[model samples]
Target: MVQVKVFDCEHEKDLEESMNKFLQKIDEKNILDIKYNVAAMVELDEDEQIYCFSAMILYRK
Candidate 1:
């Protein structure tokens, strides 16, 4: 059976961290594909002007 799930996060650093955690929650040991949603977003840090894009990581594992 194939399991699918969506993952999102707001972070100033690497987005991979959230992705990894999200995958684990769904017991996704092997990911098949990732489809990003249109609802994706981005935010800029006022102080540093650093940008962060919201992730809508959809995948099957």
Candidate 2:
């Protein structure tokens, strides 16, 4: 089993969308091959008042 966490330099919403798109790419790339798994994404911050975004991805195999 393996777990992966990815962070993006984009906004939270953009990161979510981008992650979805990239996940599709990964599917097409055949990078994930397993029966047991868990994957999740979260936006830890969303404040235009700030100049940074905090996101988290949780995955398991």
Candidate 3:
């Protein structure tokens, strides 16, 4: 059967670490693919921008 795991973090390094830890418990051969994405947005009243880091892992368990 195919399954997916999703990870999200405020920082890229955090996401990378989280993914690595999860991957360590699973069989590498079962991994089908990984998708990563980032997005940034600023509020109209704020000078700072907010960012989002996310990833998806498709695999078979």
Candidate 4:
């Protein structure tokens, strides 16, 4: 059986940082395949002062 997991994060340092952290959590070092898409988006201000983008990752282990 293949195992799948979802990881999420907000832009604090950088999106790459979030991805790295998420990758570290996965026990399987070798990923068979993976895909990612925008999971959530938020505008903190009326003028779009701040924008937040979250992503969803699908991978097989």
RMSD of each predicted structure:
5.5, 8.8, 0.8, 4.1
**How high is the CA lDDT of each candidate model?**
0.53, 0.48, 0.95, 0.57
Model 2 misplacement above 4 A = 22-50
Quality of model 4 by C-alpha lDDT:
0.57
Tens-digit lDDT track for model 3 on 3-56? 999998989999999999999988989999999999998877978888999999
Worst 10 residues of 4 by lDDT: 47-56
For all candidates, what are the clash counts?
0, 0, 0, 0
Return the lDDT, model 2, position 43.
52
User: Against the hidden reference, what TM-scores do the models get?
Assistant: 0.37, 0.36, 0.93, 0.40
Candidate 3 ranges beyond 4 A from true positions:
none
Cα lDDT tens digits, model 4, 1-61, are 4655554445645666876787897756455556554444446565454434444555555
Candidate ranking under lDDT, highest first, comes to 3, 4, 1, 2
Q: Candidate 2, 14: how far from true, in Å?
A: 2.0
Q: Model 4, which residues run further than 4 Å from truth? A: 12-15, 22-29, 39-45, 49-61
Clash pairs, candidate 1, are: none
lDDT of 1 by residue, 1-61 (tens): 5665555444524466766667676645556677653343334553443334455544444
Ranking 1 against 3 by lDDT, winner: 3
Worst lDDT run of 10 residues, candidate 2, spans 29-38
Off by over 4 Å in 1: 12-14, 22-29, 37-61
Clashing pairs in 3: none
